[model samples]
Target: MAIEPLAIGVCSWSLQVKNVAELKVFLDRLGIDVVQIACGDPHHAAWDEGDAMPAAARAAGFRMSGAMLGFPGEDYTTPQTIERTGGFGDPATRAERTERFKWALSRTKELGLADLMLHAGFIPAVGAPERKAFLDTLAQVSDLALRAGVTVAFETGQESSTLLRRTLDDLKCPNLKINFDPANMLLYDNDDPIQAIELLAPDIRSVHVKDANRPSTKGVWGEEVPLGRGQTDTRRFIQTLKKAGYRGPLCIEREAGTQSERFHDIEYGVHFLRECLAG
Candidate 1:
């Protein structure tokens, strides 16, 4: 079968603006067609206001693919947690992660979304024991997701592609997929953004279109750049995704900047990606 090119979209925190109508109007002006909502506790949640979500998207004539579900143990600074345990092998940590996973699962359903993405906890491959533990946790989470009837994805980073592939192989769950964020791999200094396409292509369900500096800084996070202007080869990346048969949304995430800057960057990114897909 022939592969299809990706559809473009934007992941916005702009909905947090006091004037959501204005924001939607702005997005429409930029021609953004999709928005990935950020899910979390009601107070800090991205689209907590009951009427904010559908109203804004409706006004703009945009579709919402899903929300980025916030999971517990997200705080890596904590002393003892799934994140500290390296994402899913410790029994106690897995229990905690399970609770967080359940919360995300329930929240996504409540939002009437069929798909969501999250950090599957990072298990650094420091040794044999750590590797085994990480695999165990991956299996457990995959099982949890199977019961939820929703697609759950692990945002790339925190591990090498080989290790991630191995982890997925061990679990063998159909629902578990990759939310391929090229900048993440580059930011972590783990792999080249373009190379990751070959390693993770088959498992990708969604993508985060952004850019970053090269991984020459050694343990430091890469700087986030606007689309088509960073270490990620946005054009080739999209072409590779198409070759891999990934047809999911290309969600543009702009993590920095003021409302004006963010809106501009995201709009620029959406257009950049649209051109990439077309080419």
Candidate 2:
């Protein structure tokens, strides 16, 4: 079997540098050919301004890869967190989140980015009205995303694979997709990342090439380890992606460590993914 060359990108959040020019230099030094800019500055709103991505992107020979939509909202796992973030339980707060998501959708289009990776609210507990509200709001936001011609993908973390699959099914929008993050499942103890990939293969639109150590001690989230150093079997994961016909960019993200460490992880992950795809 032969694997065609695929673009390898790292999430800019890992670089921990706010300036796009500095980020380009850092990624260039790490030999990263592509990058996913995850700008979280509320004031910049680069996605909305169409100026968040500096001109250096072209000069540096890197692509705008994608945008990881980050906003202050419910973390997608616990309903209480949703309430804390002014979602689900609060009607007034829910409206605010909706407007924010709309801004993100518009921002994504303004930036000429193709996808907006985010957490689609939370999965409420059984018999909870919050669950209904979350689904209802999701449908509305999804409609906006569809009209914008940009994909709004839910990151795979905080919820079970089944929950995410069901939510995606219910959204019923062509632009709705999944940004599978294997390490998140490990960190949250949601499910086996590999198995999740198998079951949700058809909807996997993007992959986060980060790794994690499964929880060994009690009450601890899985540790974020360097690519191939954690419990994630990235080679098998890539094989699964190939088998499932996922042709999207493998966006590498390092959620922990210093600037130098994150760059190292990106380097390791990009090379490992390429070799795995080739094999």
Candidate 3:
């Protein structure tokens, strides 16, 4: 079978829209029909229609590349705050987060998607006391995804690619893969995005086309900028993805601006990616 060319899409939450209707309007304006939709979870991007969102999204006509899920208490206010709350990182929240993951898996199936993307949180170092529990939680979620026939893509950046690669190796779950975001590597002041992609190439199931500059201080968050405007070197990022054999959709995610600014930036990103892909 022939491989489909990569499609350029946007994250639904990036548009900051409230419902499927609003999302459609923006998608039309952006001139793109592809999206990686939020699951309408209270924390990430809640829909005005609530429970009716799945059916509405399924009927919305846009091509959904995947679904995104964010936990309720995830705090992006600071690096430390998220380290304490993001993903399945907190041992205290593992049970509840696992249940949330179950719900997200169901939503992925309902939306006719095979991939669900989320941050697995900051990983515990290999020899740390919490390492075993963290890996076990990841395995539990991965097993759930396996049974559901959905691929769970943990977004990169919370930890170094080496640690993530090690964790994946330990779990050995075929359904668990990566949703590579080059900008995140810089934002979290983790690994070099270019090198990280090379290391995690085989497991990259999706890509987020974003850009950012490293933080000035060690513990501070980096600055997120429009595509091709920061340190991500987006043109080279696309080239690297191509060289790494990644053929998934490139979903533009701009979370740093007002809704109007975000829309404009994403629109610009569409053109930026098209130019890079063509080159």
lDDT to native, each model: 0.69, 0.70, 0.91
Give the poorly placed runs of model 1, Cα more than 4 Å off. 1-5, 14-26, 41-45, 50-61, 72-93
lDDT of 3 by residue, 1-279 (tens): 122558889999999999999999999998988899999886678999887888998898889989999999999999999999999988899899899899999999988888999999999998999999889888888889989999999999999999999989988999999999989999999989998888899999998999999999999999999999999999988998898899888999999889999999999999999999999
For all predictions, the C-alpha RMSD in Å is: 4.2, 4.1, 1.6
TM-score per model over all chains: 0.83, 0.85, 0.97
Q: Order of candidates by TM-score, top first?
A: 3, 2, 1
Q: Count the backbone clashes (under 3 Å) in each candidate.
A: 0, 0, 0
Ranking by lDDT: 3, 2, 1
**Pairs in clash, predicted candidate 2:** none
Q: In candidate 1, residue 98 scores what lDDT? A: 75
Query: Candidate 2: where is the Cα deviation over 4 Å?
Result: 1-5, 42-60, 73-92, 125-128, 217-219
Output the TM-score of candidate 1.
0.83
Question: In terms of lDDT, which candidate is strongest?
Answer: 3
For model 1, how does the per-residue alpha-carbon lDDT over 48-117 read when each residue is reduced to its tens digit?
Answer: 3444554444455556677676544344432234245544545566676677777777666765676778
Candidate No. with top TM-score: 3
Q: Could you tell me the TM-score of candidate 3?
A: 0.97
Better of 1 and 2 by lDDT: 2
**In model 1, which residue pairs have backbone atoms overlapping below 3 Å?**
none
For candidate 2, report its TM-score.
0.85
